[model samples]
Target: MSLLLLAPALLLVGVVFLWPLLRYAWLSGHAASVLTGLVPLANGGANWQRLLSDGRFWQDTLQTLRFAGVSLSLELLLGLALALLLHQPLRQRGAVRAAVLLPWALPTTVMALGWRWLLNDPYGPLNRLIQGLGGSPYGFLSTPATTWLFTVLADVWKSTPFVALLLLAGLQTIPPELEEALLLEGAGPLQRLWRLTLPLLAPYLLLAALFRLAQALGVFDLIQVLTGGGPASSTESLGLYAYLNGMRFLDFGYSATVMLGMFLLVLLLTSGLLLLRRGWQGTLR
Candidate 1:
């Protein structure tokens, strides 16, 4: 009876998600003409071969990793700080926490547009502020380094709030008595954090990191709207590259290969993290 009840949802997932992915992976090995319906030919492994040999593909992969790494690191740090701040009792804590969600709640496209305006090379608030501070107007999206920096900043801005919220929830689950007990034992704030709080927060932190990493790895809209993988392909990410290949160039075969590659990589990475977390939890037990 329970299995019958769960059948609908399972059928929906199989039809809507698994079907398309399997179809795409199967088609990715075919020739472009076959994909476009111009001819029927199975060129096994050609798409994957081309993708593997493409320097641009490797470059985009590196850029994606770099962007994810820097953004997630900063977001984790800032989120921890914000979570700690909100974990304490304060009169406006509720209001502040709600406000923190604004960035995360806003649509990614809108946020990207707002950031684009803010980082505009000419007549933008950011550049104006820089000039006012006796610095030259800087190119944010048009330069390689600046593009990466702004992309990281945008991601961190939108994502850190979510991280803070997760960590705060974790904080609430922790019994207050633990901190008080540590305090009574002459533990300083730093010592308490190291010896008590962090240890308890480990699972939550790992889970949060896993979620953030996946989100960061798949980032597309913000970078697309902000830089469009421009300035000599400096800001090209795996997502954007896949998009360009699939939609822009109509190279569905190659795009599918890229998508499949990304899917496998993310799956492996996430699995590894979860395994590590499980091991840690077992050790703690």
Candidate 2:
């Protein structure tokens, strides 16, 4: 009876998730052809060989890693700080928490577009303030470095609060008796945070990191809306590259290969993080 009950859910998962993945695995082996959708079932390893040998593909892959690395670091730090602030007893605590979450709650595409306008070169409020202060106007989205910075900023802005909320929940779950005991023992705020609080919150911290890093690795909307991989593909993440190939260029075979590669990379990264989390928990024990 239990097995039968699981059958529908299992079937749903296969239909929705497993089927598409299996199809993509098949598609990844095929090669995109100028003649049609794909070259007929390709000779063994042709797609992987090309993917490995392609300089541009490697660059885009590295770009994706680099972007995620930078964004994740920023978001984690900012989120931790915000969570600590919110964890304090303060007036308007509910209102403040809601305000902090607003950025994360906004639709990503709309938020990216909003950031674009906010940082617009000539007419943006930021540029206006810069000019008011006797600085020359800057085309933020037109330069590789500036565009990357803007994208990172937009992603950080939107994601930090989510990290904060998770950490705040963790913070609330901590036993008050432990903190009071620490205070009675003359532990400073920093000491308590580093020695007691963080040690206890390790699992939740790891969980937040895992979630945030995965999202950062696969983020698409912010890049698409803000930069469009512009300024000579400087901000092109793997996801965006695959999207353009599949949707814009109609190179579904190659796109599927890229997607498969991304999925594998994410799994590898996540596995490593999970291992680290286990090690951390062992250390805590």
TM-score of each: 0.94, 0.95
Candidate 2 lDDT score at position 213: 84
**Which lDDT values do the candidates have, in the order given?**
0.87, 0.88
**Candidate 2: worst-modelled 10 consecutive residues by lDDT:** 34-43
Error (Å) of candidate 2 at residue 82 is 0.5
Best by lDDT: 2
Per-residue CA lDDT of model 1 for 1-285, tens digit only, reads 999999999999999989989988886887664356734357898888998899998898889889988998898889988999999898898898899889999999999999999999977999999999999998888877668888899889999999999999998898999899989999999999888888888877887899988987887898899889888999988999989887887777788889887777678778988999879889888
**Native-vs-model 1 lDDT?**
0.87
Candidate 2 lDDT tens digits, 1-285:
998999999999999999999998888777665546456556467777878897778888888898898998899899999999999998999999999999999999999999999989899999999999999988999988657878888999999999899999999999999999999999999999999889887877888889988898898999999988888998899999889888888777788888899999889998999999889878877
* Backbone Cα, N, C clashes tallied per candidate: 0, 0
- Clashing residue pairs, backbone N/CA/C < 3 A, model 1: none
